[model samples]
Target chain A: MGELRLMKGNEALAEAAVRAGSDGYFGYPITPQSEVIEYLMAEKPFERTGMVVLQAESEVAAINMLYGGGGTGKKVMTSSSSPGISLMQEGLSYMAGAEIPCIVANIVRGGPGLGDIQPAQSDYFQSVKGGGHGDYRLPVLAPASVQEMSDFVPISYDLAFKYRTPVLIVSDGLIGQMMEKVELFDQMPRITDKEINEKYPWATNGKPKGKERRILTSLDLDPHKLEKHNFHLQDKYKQIEANEVRYELIDCDDAEYIIVAYGSSSRISQKAIQLARAEGIKVGILRLITLWPFPKKPIDELVIKGIKGFLAVEMSAGQMVEDVKLTVRERTKVEHFGRYGGVIHSPEEVLEALKTKIIGG
Target chain B: MSEIAIQDIIKPENLVYEKTKLMTDKTLSYCPGCGHGTTHRLIMEVIEELGQENETIGVAPVGCSVLAYEFMNVDMQEAAHGRAPAVATAIKRLWPKKVVFTYQGDGDLAAIGTAETIHACNRGEQIVIVFINNGIYGMTGGQMAPTTLPGMKTATSPYGRDIATMGNPLKITELVAQLPGTYYVTRHSVHTAAAARKAKRAIKKAFQNQLDGKPGLSFVEVVSNCNSGWKMEPVQSNIWMEENMFPYYELGDIKVDGKLLSK
Candidate 1:
C-alpha cells in the first residue's frame, strides 16, 4: 500500500496514470469526465514524473496524438464522454489496425446522440463489438468502484502492452463522479527511450543503427495482404479470449437464480441479490470485470450446474443481454431488465423485475 | 592509340553530386514524372544536409505521398487523411528536442484536415508542414481538390469548375500565413532547375528553424503538377501549370519571421 486517499473516481484515475508511469496524456474536456484532465493539470505530472499532458483542440486531435505518441512505444491515454468518444472511433480503428498499445476511458453518458450527461451503460456494444469501421476489437474493462477505477489504469496498460492492442475502460458517470477511499499503488518509473528500444524493438522511435526503419501504419492496399493482416488480428483476439476472462461471483454457490451485470449495475444487483436471499429466495450475481473477453466460461459452468434463470440488469435497455443469451444458448432462461436515457435502476426495481420476469416466470 | 586508364580519367574529384543517403533503398511508388518524387528528394536532401536524419520523425499523410515512409529513411507514422499535422504536433511536443514534420497534399491539408492544420499553426507548434498543392487529388484518381483552380475541369468537375455553385479555389497557404504562430511561410515550385534549387533552400530553412528553437510553425507549399490527374503529357502539364497555376498561386515568400508579407 502506497497511500490511502479519498478522491473522486476520475481524479483517482488521473493520479493512477501518473503513478503508472504513463508517458503522455492528451484529451479534450467533456462533462462527467473533465476531472481527469483537470487533475492531471493541477498535479503537474510533468514536474513529478516528467509526464506530458496536453489539452487538445478536440477529441479528434487528442486521439491522433495518442496514435503518434503510442507509435513511439510510449504509454499514452485519454478520457472522454459519449459524444467525444464517438468522435474518436476513426482514430481508434486506425490504432487497432496498426496494433498501437494505448488506453482510452469512456465515462459513458446516455446516448444515441448526446442523450444526457448522467451515467448510462448504453455504449456496451460500441466498446465491445468494434465501434470503428474495420473488423477490430478493443479489450474493454468495467470498473465497479472508485478503487477499481484507480486500479484498472495500470492493469489496462499492462494488458495493452502485452497484446499490442488498445484497451478501453468502459466506465459510467456514477463511478466517475463518486468519491471513495482508494489505496493507491507505488509509483512506477517512466520507461526510458533506451529501455523502450530494448523492449519494443519495432517501435518508431527514430530507428537505431543497423536496424530497419519502422513505419507505423494501417494502410495495406494489396487485397491479399490486407486479408492476411485481418486474419492475424483475429488470431490475437482469439488468444485473448482463451487466456484473459475475469469476473466475480457474489454468493453464487447453491443459487437457484443469478443476475448478470457490470459497473454500477453490478453494484445494484449485489444489493438485489442480498435482498432476495433474505426472503429465502436463492439468488446471486456475477459481476463481469472484463466485458470484451467476457467471462463466458464461468457462465457456461454455472449453466452446467443447472441454474434456474438469469436477469441481465443494466442502465441501458438490454445491450449486454445479447451476449448473455449467446453464452447461455437456451440452457436456462435469460431475460433483461433496465432503465434508459440516463435513468438508473434501483435495487428494489431490479429485484422486483427478477422475481416477476425471471425467477417467478 | 594507347587506351587511357579508365580509373585515371574518372577521379573522385570529378563527381558532381550523389543521391542523399537519407533516402532508403526502397524504390519510390510514385508515378513516373510525378512531382512527389522531386518533392520527396528535396525534403530528404534537406534533412541530410541538416544532419537530422537520426533525430527526425515524419508524419506521412494520405494521398499519393502516403508511402513516403518507404522512401524516407527515418522513423515515421502514417496518419489518416488530413490528420498529419495533429500527429506531428503530438510527436514534437512529446519529444521537444527532436525534429518533426508532416508531409501532406492539397486534399489532405487544404480540405479534410483544415481544422488540424489551422489549430496547429495557430498554437505555434515547433514543427514543419510540407504542403504539396497540385490542384487535384492524385492518389484516389483525378478528382477536384480544395485548391482546384476556377474553370479547371476534373473528374468531379466535368463541365469545368463553376465558381457560382462549387466555390472558388482555396488559397490555404495564404490563410495559414495570417496566423501569429507561423515563423516562416513560403510558396515555391520545382518545374525548373532554378525553382527546384529555391524549393530545396526553403525546405532546409524550415528544418533549420526547428533546430534554432523558433517558436512557430514553418509551412513550405510547393506548387506541383499532376500530369495524369490533369490528363496531359508530363511536359504539357508542366507548361499548363506554369501558365495557369503559377499565375493564381504566385510563388515567393508569403510571410517571414512571423510577419505576413505585403501583396
Candidate 2:
C-alpha cells in the first residue's frame, strides 16, 4: 500500500520514527543497535520533518533526555542494547513514577554482563517483568519480522500517550541486523507547539498567559500521597491488561502439541511446526506479540480443548516458560528448549527439542 | 514614631524592595541561613525582570533544592540526582525558542553528574546552568562532595578531607570555562549583601546569553555556605567562608564572552 523497500530492521525503525512524526530521538550507540542512530544521522530527519536527533554521551544521559523531552508532551524515543538498557534502569523508574510517555526499543544481545553481540531472548523476564525498580510494568511488544519492526514505532507512541506510560519494543540482534522487505507508513506531521499545549495540559512546555504553571516530578515525601499515586498507576496497568493483549494462534485447532514462542523464536518454531506436521506429529505454534499481558485466555482455551503438551521455545535459558507454566497450571505438560548465550537454534533443533523435552519426557 | 500607620509603610511608592511574584507562596524547604533561598529568589527575579516569566522552563536538581519546582511557580521539571544538565539539554534542543536553565548543587553538578555537566558544556548547548558549590552534600545530611576543600571535615570525612586519599577539589567552573563550547563562565559568592548583588548580575547575564541565542552554554557558579553541615552559627560560617573558602575558591568573573580571564 505505502512505499515498499528492502531495509535492515534497525534502519527501517529509524525511518519509521521520522515518518511517525516523532519530535525528538536521543540515543547512544551500542552493538547490534548502533545502526539506529547511524541511520538517523545519514537520513537527517531534522532537515526533512523538523525532527531532532542527538547522540547522547551515555545511555544514562539518553534516557533522561527522553524524560525531559517527553515531559514537554513531545513524542520522544530511544534505542539501546542489553548492557545499555541496564544502565538506563534508574531513569526508566523515574520516568515511570513521573508518568511520562516515551518509547524505548531494546535490540537484545546476549548478556549477564556484556555476554556477546548475538541474538538472545534472555531479557524476557526483564522486559515483561519490571526491568526498573518499583511496582511498575512496561507494555512490551515483541516483533518477529522487519515489517513489524517498522510498524511498531507508531503503535508504541500511540500506546505510550494513550496510557501516559513508557512502552518497550523488544527485538534482538537477528532482526536488527537482517535485511528484509518492509512497507513504510505514510509520513505524519509533527505536532505544533500550540497543539502540544492543547493536547497535554499537564505538559511542562511553559506557562501560557493566564494559565497555571505545570510541574512534573515523582518525589512525593508523604507516604499516603505516594500510595495513592501507586494505586492510580495500578489501575492504568489493569486497563492495559484488559484491552491490549495481542497474540497469534497458528494451526492451534486439533493440535496435539503447541509450541509457544515470540519474536525470532516464533519464526523458528513456525518452520519446526511444518517438520513435525510432516511426520504426523499434529503440532502447532502460539506466537506472542505482546509479552506483558501474556495472552492467557487463548492458551486456556487450548488447554480446555485437550492439548497434550506445550514446548516453550526461546533463545535463552528459559524465561518465558515460567509464564506459560503459570498459565497452564499443571493442566498440561509445559517444557522449555533453546540454545542460549548467542547460539541460534535451527528448525530441526527445535523439532528435536520438542520431541525430547515434551513428547518423550 | 509610635503612631506611624502600617498602610503608609506598605504603600507602593514607599516600597523600596518587593519579592518577585514569580515565586510561589509555598514555604522554601531550605534552612534559614542557607543560600538556596536567596539564589532561587534571584533567578526568579531575573526571569521576571526580563519579562520572560511565561517563556522559561527550569530543571531542578536532587539536592536540598530538589523541591525547587514547588517554590518556582513557572513550568518546572525535577531531574534525577546529577542529571539536570542532561534533562535541560533535551528541553532546550526540542524547544529552541524557549529559555531553559538548570539549578543544581555541588554534589549534583560536580560529583555524580560530572559526565552530564561536562558533555552538555562540550556540546555548546544553548542553556544556562546555575551551579551552587557548597563543598558538601546538604540534602542527604552533609556527605563529602567533589568540591570539598582539602582538610575540610564532612560526614563522610570525619577526620578532615585527606587530599592524598580523597583527591583534590574540582574547580568545575574553571574546568568548563576552558571548553570551547562555553560562551560565558563565572564564579561568585552570595554570603553577603554586596556579594549577593554581584551574583545576581552574573545570573542575569547567563540568562541573557541564552536569550540572545549565544552559540554556547552559559554557566554561573555561586560558592555558598552550609552552616548546619559545617557545625557553625550563620554569622560565624560566613566569616569562616571569608577567611578560608575565599582564598581557595576565589570569587569574581572567570570568563566573559567566551574568553577566559587571565589570573
Candidate 3:
C-alpha cells in the first residue's frame, strides 16, 4: 500500500518482484533491461528481505541460476534483453521440462541479431510459443504500461507457483524505458521455515528415505517415461490455454473496425482508437495482455460479430498477427503492419494505417 | 520386559531422513546403464554420512540430472544447464549456514554453462559441484558433448568428433582446479566398484570443505556411460569406458586441502 510514484517499467518490475516475496534474482545487465538489475543493485533487496541478487556473468548464467533457484521451490527470476534471452533458451527448455517454477522477464529489443537498444516486439513468437527447444510453452504476459510491469511481475510469480511452471513477463524496449506512475504493493511477509518444510515436500534439500530419491531433471533414458513426461507437459499447456487468456477492449461496443495489438504497440493503438473516435469513426482497440494465451476468446467474439477487419500493429514484422488470423479462422480480414529492428511505430503511424484500412479517412 | 527394546539399538534405519523431508513420490526413469543412477546414489551416501540430510540443498542442472530434485530426499533447487554454479553461489551466499551443492552433466558444465562455472570457481563460492561426464548428450538423443573425445562419434558428429570442426574437448576438473576458489578437484569413473568407492571419498571431502567454514568450490567428475546413446550392452560399455576412456582421463584427486591421502 503505497502512493503512486514515477518509475521506469523495468525498475517497477524489480521492486514488484521483491514485494512478491521472491527469494532470488539472477540476471545479466543488457540494455533496456539493464535498469531492472540497476534497481536491484541499488535497493539491495537481498539484505532486507533475504533475497539473493546477483549480476551474473552472462544471460546464460542468469537463466541457469534461475533454474537452480526455481528447482528448489524458491521464488527465483531473471531479466534480460533479446540477445541475452536467446542465450537462455537451453536453460528455459530445461526449466519447462523439469517443471521448475520461476519467473523470467524479457525486455525485448529489436533483433534478428544484435539489433538495437531501441524498442522492438519481434520476440512475440519466441515469448508466446516455446522460446526454447522441445514441445512446451512458457506462459507469457505482456504489459502495456509501466503500471502493468509492476502488476504483471507479481501475477507472473503467482502463476508460476500455482502451476509449478515457468512464467514469462515479456515487455519491449518502449515500456521498459518509458516512465510512468506505478503503485507499489505492500511487501508480503515471506513464508516461514516451518511453512516451507511443510509446503515443498517435493523439493530436494538432501536426505534420503525409503521414498524414491527426488530428481529435478528433464531427461529419461527410457522412451516410455520420457513420453509420459511429455504428455503431462502437454496437458499443462492445454490447461493454460483454456484458463489464462486476457485482453483489453476499447470502444468495441460501437466499433465497426477492430485493431489488434499488444505490448508497446498496444499503447500506440490506444491513441489511434481515441483519434478515430474524435472523427466519428467507430474504431475499437483489442490490446492483448497475455501473449501466449493470445486473447483468443475476445478475438473470436469480435470475428463472429461481423467486425469488418483488423489491422495488426506490432513492432515485429508479423508474428502475433498470424495467431490472430488463425484464431479468427477467416471469419474477418486481418491486415498485418509492423516494423522490425529497433524501430517502434509512432501513434501517428498506427493511425495512418487505420485511416487507410479501417476508416478510409 | 523380555521383548527387544525398540529404541535402544542403533537402528541405522531409524536415522532415515531429515526435517525437510522434501521427496517426491516419483519412480526413476534412468536406463539400466545410465551413470545418473550410480552418481545419485553416491551423493545420497554422502548426505547420509554427514547427517545433514535435511539442511543440505542440492542444485540440479539441465541435462539428465535436471529431474534429480524429484528423486533426492532433500530440499533441492534446479539450475539452468550450466548455471548450477551461479545458483549454488547465490543459495550459499544468501543462506550461509545451509549446505548447498550443484549436480551437472558435461554439456551443462563444460559447454554452454562454462562461463558461469568458471566464474563461480574464480569467486571461490563455498559449494560442491558433482560433475557427471558421460561424453555425449544422452537426453537429447546422443548429440555431441563438450567432453566428447576427439574421433568419438555422436548424432551431431556423424563421422566422428573432428577436432578442427567440433573444437577441443572440455576438461572441467582440470580447468576448475586452476581456480583459487577451488578447495578440491578430483576425477573418478563409476565403471568399477573401486572407482565408485574412491568417488564416494572424493565427494565426502568436497562437502566437508564447505562445512569447515573454508568456503571452496569442489569438483568431482564421475566418468559415466550412457547405454541408450552408446547403443551397447551395459557390461560392454563399462569395459570400453575402462580400457579406452580411463587412459585419457586418469582418475585421482588432482587437488585436496585437508588430510592428505598418498597418491
lDDT of 2 by residue, B111-162 (tens): 8999999999999999999999888999899989999999999999999999
**What value does the lDDT take at residue A138 in candidate 1?**
88
Off by over 4 Å in 3: A207-212, A221-225, B1-42, B57-97, B103-108, B132-171, B187-199, B222-254, B258-263
Which residue pairs of candidate 1 clash? none
Per-residue lDDT of candidate 1, residues A1-361 (tens digit):
5799999999999999999999999999999999999999999999999999999899999999999998889999999998999999999999999999999999999978978999999999999999999999989999999999999999999999999999999999999999999999999999998889899976887768767778899999998999999999999999999987888999899898999999999998888888888899898899999999989999999999999998899999888999999999999999999899888999899989999999778
What digit string (tens of lDDT, one per residue) describes model 3 on residues A1-361?
6868899999999999889898889888899889988999899997779888888888777777776667666788888999999988888898888888889998999888998899998998888789889998989999999999998978898889777788998898889999999998889776665565477765554443454445567776689999999999999988988988888897899888988988888888888778878878788889888888778889888987889888899998999889988888888678888988988788777878887765563
For residues B32-98, write the lDDT of model 1, one tens digit per residue: 7678888889999998888887888999999999999989988999998889988888888878888
Those runs of model 1 whose alpha carbons end farther than 4 Å from true positions after fitting are B1-11
Docking class of 1: medium
Per-residue alpha-carbon lDDT of candidate 2 for residues A1-361, written as tens digits (9 for 90 to 100): 9999999999988999999999999999999999999999999999999999999999999999999999999999999999999999899899989999999999999988989999999999989888888999889999999999999999999999999988999999999999999999999999899899888998998899898899989899999999999999999999999999999999888799999999999998999999999999999899999999889998999999999999999999999999999999999999999789888889999999889988988
Worst lDDT window (10 residues) for model 3 chain A?
A204-213
For residues B110-201, what per-residue lDDT tens digits would candidate 3 score against the true structure? 98778888999888888898998888998889999988888888999989999998898877778788777777888997767787788888
Judge the docking of candidate 2 as incorrect, acceptable, medium or high. Answer: high
Provide per-model DockQ scores: 0.77, 0.88, 0.39
